[model samples]
Target chain A: MLKKGIKYTVALILLLIVGYNSVYIKKLSEVKAAAATGKFDATLYAQTFWQEKLTPGLAKANNLPELLTLLKSDKENAFKNYSHALGIGNLRYFLIKGIGKITASNENDISVTLLPDSVGQEVKLATEFVYGNAVRDALGILSINDFSNTMDMNNVSAEINKKIRTEIIPPFRAQAKKSDVVAFTGAIELNQVHLRLDEIEVIPVSLNLIQK
Target chain B: MSPKVFVKEEKAQVQPPTLKAPAFSGSYSRYLVKFQSLIALFILCLIISLLSDKFLTVANGWNVMRQISVNICISVGMTLVVLTAGIDLSVGSVLALCGAITAGLLKFGIELPSQDLFIGFTLLGVVLAGLLTGTLLGTFNGWTITRFKVPPFVATLAVLTIARGLTMLYTKGFPISGLGADFAYIGTGWLLGIPVPVWISGIIVGLAVFLTNKTRLGRYIYAIGGNESAARLSGINISKVKTTVYAIAGGLAAIGGIIVTSRLDSAQPNAGISYELDAIAAVVIGGTSLSGGRGSILGTVQGAIIIGVLNNGLVLLNVSPFWQQVVKGMVILLAVIIDKANSKSE
Candidate 1:
């Protein structure tokens, strides 16, 4: 009887271990699936998982899109978030792709190219395509998916507010500059873009001409 | 009973001739734990390298080292704290607070760039600032743990939330920027083809190793960890030792914060969240007993590298971030289970 009891206990333990392993495998598989899809609905998953499992205060406090950016920036952070909310792991792939340009070709529908700028490397649109009668407006559509996520929308609005009020509007209003504009585009617009500078250093030049 | 009968009875029990054998048993067990952990770390690193081409790159290797340095520094101190059966969850938040203060000082030039904020003076002042802040916070934790008899886990957990909240209030939700080029150099620069953060971490690890192996204080730490009541009976100053251990932990965590801020060139008030767990994980993987009294600095360094390689390799392979977490959790769980089995055998 004792031997039989021991066998039963061992079997139970093995079953528990297998169950745990199965759950882990499932979570990992889900994360991988979500990461593969560029347009997966991360917000829905984040909200649902948070509501069902995570602490309510934490769920409500975290700004999902900003947190998504933070996770993609570092692997350790990504793993840490994935361990907590698997939804974060799924969103990070899209977040990184978003940071760079996403290109669509005839066969290769999406590719991203990095460009070196004054500040740092930035993703620029490579395709010459226009949407809704505007060439520059096409860039706006790329970020529209980002805005569709409510959490990301909040971050964008906050950044735009900060730039408009604390940066652009103050200087423009002070100098009475009328033509300054802020546009979100994937590529540079030749004629429509306005240049704004906080300070400029001028160099003096001498030109000598002889007339006959 | 006859002498022959007594001898036969003792032989039947397989009793050793002396108690010294069991005394030596503990050391042997410790050695086994260390060996097993080293083997695990070796296998982990090997697997990661084979799986990802990017893992073996010189630049990526340096980046991994640079990335793990801060966490390792904190783990070195954390190992000591945990050895005394205590914890410091506030390390992460403390790191942010220190970074914020340091960057805030730099932004306004509270000290003049050349005159007052020369390398020697500025660096010294920053170190002192970190030390003071860390020590005070650690001392606060130690005091509550000792005086109020609070559990290390609960007390430190409370401090973690409080410190993070204070950081947000202090920074008003924006990162502190405009640090000096000199300050930024610590994070980005290299010495002898190695990043400064890596060099600094190496020095810190060496110091911890020396302290643990070659000092009387180190002996007491193990003694306290092995058995607190017995250690107190032996006349070790329990409260003082505990306080000092936690203070050192805080100071070490502060150094990590300094390194991170320098690298980013700005101090994000919210940076370093969940850092305590990484430090603890590294310490445990290195074969440190969570219950305290058994660990080594060298082991912790190896553990840190294992985690660093895992992170870097996964990114290089472009493994879905979700799966990476699953893998990490499994590794940690396995390590812990192995550690427990080894402990029981000892």
Candidate 2:
């Protein structure tokens, strides 16, 4: 009689587990389908985000006054102006394109003064923020404002920046030696304003030697 | 206790029919005992799922499985340890030590040519260091316990603090990072779309089930747990079995440690902090008798899944971290209470 009770109990437990798991499975598929469209497509976000937002925003600023004016008055707008495409903190990145004359080279980092073209003002390019989240925060694309309290965004910033440093910077370093006119699209941060605007730094996302 | 000891001493002069039950047989009585934990797990799952839509999702299912893989791996070995009527509190510390050793070696010590490195013996040093450290620690624990006649609890507790100290001294409390993709694949890679840790744990669980079910060592373990003197009288080497069980437990814990370190792309010296308690909880909640020798891998699996599900569900429900702790403790207490009550009734 006890054995019968044990067998029935086991059976019932197994059935309950199976039933619960099936319900969970159903919910999982729905989330997967929804996530397939957005939220989890990290690579998709990374690849297309630059062309859509950063370049246009960077082209809008011609001089230190314009960049600083934007920075001081509406820090959110300043970040939003750059990240308006994905919205603030939507990405840890973006891309901006501009032509600059290389004035100096520091190994992987090169100092380029922007050539007045679209924005119509020459400004020194600062790569001093090269080592950290200066580029991620400058872009204001990472959606960090959304989760400021809950997480340390440093690791994610490091991860995205590390890829940029290793994969994107090497060739640019070799090509943009002093005196080269370079066309580049890259990620920069407006974060550390204690430094002058051009001296602040842009981590180049992509670079091309427009003229040797 | 005194009357029993006196009766046993008196019985030494005359043969007596000793009342003994099979240590871990799926016998009718033992089945009822195992069933109690299973029922707890099922009830927990059902309630948690009903309360949270996110708890029942596929992504969360994988998340839970991945989260529990380390616990499951260590628990298998813990089950064996408990089956021998012994406890191993050092498994967590051993995990940290081995994880630190392996990651430190890979990230800073070992150098491989950049080309075709993935297919090379790139991970050989990491694996060797982890497994070797695990074995040595296990042997040390065993040596301290068996040779000095130290209690298993005391021996393992001492080793626990020792191993943690060793880890901190070795890593200088820094996380070892930049292990690269090839090494990371051990934990983060997928096999047939399942996380690599899950695959590895699944295989280890299968092997553990086989080892405990199909080997002479398994039966001997049961014998030792059921009654030590009887096992010794039957010519089983108590020292050897205990050492082997500890060694297996340590080695499995190392595998778990390595996988976790690889998943995070780094190993923190503080990894596996308090994790031994989790593995013990898995074993206990699975209906393994703390007294010794009456448990199954199946029960522990249920116990692990229950834990994983509970954690995932609580987070999905957006409960406060403090409240989550309270709820988790209450549920764990409830599961064990039910298990104890059912066992007593039986």
Candidate 3:
């Protein structure tokens, strides 16, 4: 009799789980349907992320000069404090703001010399092609788990990169001259082992020319 | 004393008549249990084929085979471990670590102290490195279990965490990518129009079958699982047999890791997360006794295929991934229940 009771309890629990799963599946299907029909808007999500999260979060970003100093002194601690990774095996992303003059300019990258002109520290602001998960993961605000699948998560990243290309990069490229003092906030990705401290490539979120 | 022995003999003779019916049923149920997984596989395939038009196609058949190849490799090793009444939770973590090591070796060749003796990343070197890493880790698990009297579960569980942590540290929590074409061929390349992984798994299954059926060590493994004290009394080196079994399991897991890494062309530190569960489920669903001394490699192969087909068919039918998890759990439970009923009859 006890065995029968235990079996019944297990069955009941399984049924409850199945029922709960069915509801989750229903909700997921609805989301999938929206995705299929192109109703789920990644561009809109990216826009909201830019205005509400990325721009607002810039104030909390690590200062470039300070971060470089920390990186030089202690690499691991600097990563722990400044960089963000969405999960294990993911590249670490950092949101950084700096006041720098464009020391070198090219079609691809604009080299910036951080203020007080430290000799070996150079930051390259990417003006041509913005790639990778830097902008999406840098602020550590957008989570992949929030999306339905990796494809959707990736779509958000693509949209964010597109936003950087269209709105952020064009104006900065048009008005800015070489050696112009500029204040910039951007996201940079780094592999832990290879620091590449000599040249830090950044995907700019916002860049403005400042009068010295 | 003679009179008492005679009386007992008479009683034993008398018991046969009463025991005859149950004896017949026991043998019948044993046979039923033996073929149970195979029957289930056939039925599952039928159901899936009926449900989806794409299921029975040659292309999809090959696709399913390729998909299950890695699981089959792991499950084959898992079958041996289960037969010895042991479990290796470290297989998944070992896979990740080995994959990372292999990818790292390929991407960044090791520098030897002697300037001229640098060991550049050759395909052979990377493969050996991955296999050696797995074997060493498995040996450690076996050694801990035997030498320290640590339970297999606890020992392997510890190794699981250690290996995964090591993998994270080695890769610095980033994926190692761009393994050259020679290494990629092991996973993605085809032989006679079948995937290379499928070929590798087939060879492993063949070798495992021979090892389990035709070797003295295999017999010892079964014996130890059947009754440890009896086997020990019978002059079996239980420690050696058990250790060897675990090492084989670890090596096979490394092969699975290599295949996964080659297929993706990248070794993610988080590769093979929770893979141990899938492998354990496959072993159980294959009709292997969790208590040990009973199971076959073919059953595990079938079980892995069943899972692969279920996954494929569900996607074809547009079933949600969440529902697939639910269904897989239900199937495993049902298989175990059936196994229990069969064993009870015996």
Is model 1 an incorrect, acceptable, medium or high docking prediction? incorrect
lDDT of 1 by residue, A1-212 (tens): 99999999999998776545322212334444554785435455434433453222222222223433454465465333332211222211111112222222222112322221222232222222211111112112223333333334334333432333343333322422122221212112111112111111100010011111
Tens-digit lDDT track of model 1 for B40-69: 767867887788766667888788999999
The better candidate by DockQ, 1 or 2, is: 2
On TM-score, the stronger of 1 and 2 is: 2
DockQ agreement of candidate 3 with the native complex: 0.02
Give Cα-based local distance difference scores for all models: 0.63, 0.73, 0.86
Across A71-140, the per-residue lDDT of candidate 2 in tens digits comes to 6677666554553332232233333556778877763357666665444434444333456554545554
Runs off by more than 4 Å, candidate 3: A1-212, B1-31, B112-118
- Tens-digit lDDT string for candidate 3 (A1-212): 99999999999998776445322112334444554795457888888888898888999988888988988899999898889978785369999988898888887989888887754477899998898889889888777558744545777889999988988899889888887999999988887766878878989988999953
TM-score of chain A of each: 0.23, 0.49, 0.80
lDDT of 2 by residue, B1-346 (tens): 9999999888865654342334434376656665766666678778888888777788888889999999999999999999989999999999999999887766445333443122112476567669889988988887878899999999999999999999999899888776767888998888898998999889999998898899999899888998999999999999999899999999999998898888877788889987888888888888787778788887888888877777787777777779977876786677678767766866
Runs in model 1 with CA error above 4 Å?
A1-212, B1-32, B109-123
Indicate which candidate wins on lDDT: 3
